[model samples]
Target: MTGPTTIGAAPYDALLLFSFGGPDEHDDVMPFLRNVTAGKGIPDSRLAQVAEHYEHVGGRSPINGQNLALMAALRAELSRRGVELPIIWGNRNWAPYTRDALIELRDRGATRVLALVTSAYSSYSGCRQYREDLALTAGSLEEELGHDLGLRFDKVRSYFNHPGFVAGNTDAVVEAYEQLRARGADLANAPLVFVTHSIPDTMEDASGAARPSYRTQHLDIAAVVAEQAGQRLGVDLTWSLAFCSRSGPPSQPWLEPDVNDGLRELAAGGTTAVVLAPIGFVSDHMEVVYDLDTEAMETARELGLTAVRAGTVGTRPVFVEGLIDLVLERAAVERGESPARAVVGRLGPVADACLPGCCRQRAGVDSGVPALCGQD
Candidate 1:
């Protein structure tokens, strides 16, 4: 593994907590939809149809509020631990945008900042797109605001293998298992299925990691969770990776063994119950609520399989503490100090930040760079 760079003498002036924003009310739904699907030839009528999903959920996604709460929790935790860096929030598609956050930071005399993205894996949308967003935001600030903002933004690495993340997710799965057991389901006979968002196959193949492994990371975490839970409960567990929220055209191949199809297979095999452990996502977003809970639940009902989806790793104490650990480790490394390795025991080494050229975006024709944040 490449050793982390020495921690810089200069401390980070601000910590930018970046995330994908959501609408809070009914009227905000259409505009949010447009923001998410600005390009890709999706018609306004189709967008309106899609808006119904948000409308059904009261035209608000709990993600924004949840993130706000998380920010508060993280700040309090950091302050309690004596890490006095100021934490601010920015959304990629809504109210407090990257640009707005940068302006605030600059106005507050922040010269260097650390960005902690909510995404965990390596993909065009997960990694490269965020960098593009930062670059674009910086350029726009220079052009529109007429301010030469000399800001340096560094992103934290993926924490899939961190002890806190693993522990938090493990707890979530075990909680789900207990709930199933309480429902009179036979946990001993049920299958443990891990679910995540399905990205295009081409993107997966192009991902640049130390071992060119994306699925392995998720699978590793699930296996560890299953083993630990199994030992504690004295139940045999089998785990499989299932995909969800595939949105591209039918012809464009995405991840395989979709969650709905997996449910049918499990039912066909006479599996009595199944637990969906979402190790791929950090929060319960539209995909988790509408796609998995709503659509996948319907499929599970049709197939006669009792499916239970676990909670996400959002703002849990362990999760927030893990973020603090990551920040401290990165900061120490930036200071030229060797940060001690903290293992999850089950999951492997956690990455501190993505390396250059990792998760490259697919090339665009005339624009040169892959489109970021849905081209206008």
Candidate 2:
């Protein structure tokens, strides 16, 4: 083959798209919430308040649609390259469980598979938990079938530093700036705020120095987008990282400043215009729809400030191409061939095989679960 994947998943027979599942309808709401907060002992009454957010939006999460779009885009890209690859999908929390997807792959006669998770950054909830879930699911499926399916799974490296992700975020910010300027919003003093889902601060500290922490990952990408957008706009862009979707016990601390809080401060600081870029997500999921589009937008209106919400890199051509590049690079690596690892901004490239201690639940403490898909 002239290029990687031209023959289609050379070392890997299939590909799995892993993601955080969400409810599909009104009836699925409470069950989905229970699935998401199983061990946390959150009462239905408390969860109902959160459920209202879903109920407000017709009781469905856009994540499933987002994943489907990505899969379609991936198929189109692979087809354009004249490669045929089977893309199966699974989730940890909801329907189309990981076990079912693995069984489908096994039945497809796939002996080796490469997985790509929805999260671009590495964290316990994002990375290690996914590895743990996949291993557990495949093992259970093997037991159910009473034999080794001869199936093995590998995953592509994290794409936080990939040029495709950087460029997508940069373009989003530039476009948001352009939209606001068209609406007569003052650009001379507006701030661009980059937003992401907030994890517990402890989790942030636990993401470790060897690999970029979750917070560090957002900051790195935000800085690059800020600089690039500034070049496009011919002015220095003032930007800062903010968080959305904080849902935890009030007793425990999470990341700050919250997007609403930050917006208030920005209003007080005489910033009459702003742009919010959700760099932490691959798609415009629930948090992005609710936190920014609903709550934050209202706050902005009340404060009499002009605001624009930027788009996520969902199914963007470059992002899809970048994912294809990573898939091919990992395939080449599996075949024992050296391939160029693409990266941008501050970090070089994350390892294809995770370190034993990568993305612990708590700083210096493992989750006490055996995670698979790591060299360790």
Candidate 3:
């Protein structure tokens, strides 16, 4: 375990790498799915179906390992930046859960900690749910331990439009296009498809009120990457946003058109190939691996169109450096220092803290619980 350094410009002494956890083996798949879909009333049959997706990838999701790698990377980056802080990790699901991590932080004498959630958008599932996890875990800890623990957790600002994130996606898109061209794809006819996880329409409608919401965030990032990648390829590229990994009751509506459907439509429109850029996600999780790489790729094959999937900002050098920048920026703000806020897209600068009702949960959920960070 790397020891803490002088990263406490804001009185914060620790960093938490919070993420959505995944199962590590076939035997753990059902239990992992149950953990994920808990309180959703999803049927066992449905969970079994979902388990197949994890099973397809060896009954495990790569996100936990990725988070571990990211934790190490951020530690190294923070150390290199001279902000000596102990960084720990916790997940919303699976082992090393948020409560456990908080216990470790509490034992380490960390009173104030900055959290870096894996998701970078403002939506119920992406942003708000993470806040909920932190709050719930903290409440549980206090209740179970019968002590305040003096823990204060503040989340970093959303980085959907950060230059490092945008640059990484742009580079990945350019690389995907290059690979497609090498595979006899005619760049002139290949349309860019930007894909993201589809939330319910109501959830999308209610995402950040004072700032760009979830759907809008994804769209903005897509536009930025598409424009920059187009400039790199020296061509005016046409692009559209598509949704994937939709799960709900048959009657309930989610975002559309699905990626497979988009591919089919592109094929019908006489498009020979498409470059898929999943700018909506920060890393390659099960959604990207199975939904895009396996399912959508299969659809493209059936439609006789060549498809190439771009990478996410998974430990990219620029992205890692950007995380450090964000941490320092928050610390500066905490210390009453004026730091130039960093943003790469046009819809920003988003607030380092969220306003009340920003990214509100869908109706029927409690919104009054004090968010540990980023809500004014």
Q: Please give the CA lDDT of all the candidate structures.
A: 0.78, 0.88, 0.85
Q: In candidate 3, what are the lDDT values of residues 134-219, reduced to their tens digit? A: 88889988999898979987888988888888888898999999998799877878999999999898788778556776878888
lDDT tens digits, residue span 270-348, model 1: 9978898888888888888988889888988888788899998898999999888877777777677887867654445
lDDT of 1: 0.78
Question: What's the CA error at residue 120 for candidate 2, in Å?
Answer: 0.7
TM, every model? 0.90, 0.97, 0.96
Please name the candidate that would achieve the greatest TM-score relative to the true structure.
Answer: 2
Best by lDDT: 2
Candidate 3 lDDT at 29 equals 86
User: Considering only N, C-alpha and C atoms within 3 Å, which residue pairs clash in candidate 2?
Assistant: none
**Candidate 2, lDDT over the whole model:** 0.88
Q: How well does candidate 3 score on lDDT at residue 254?
A: 90
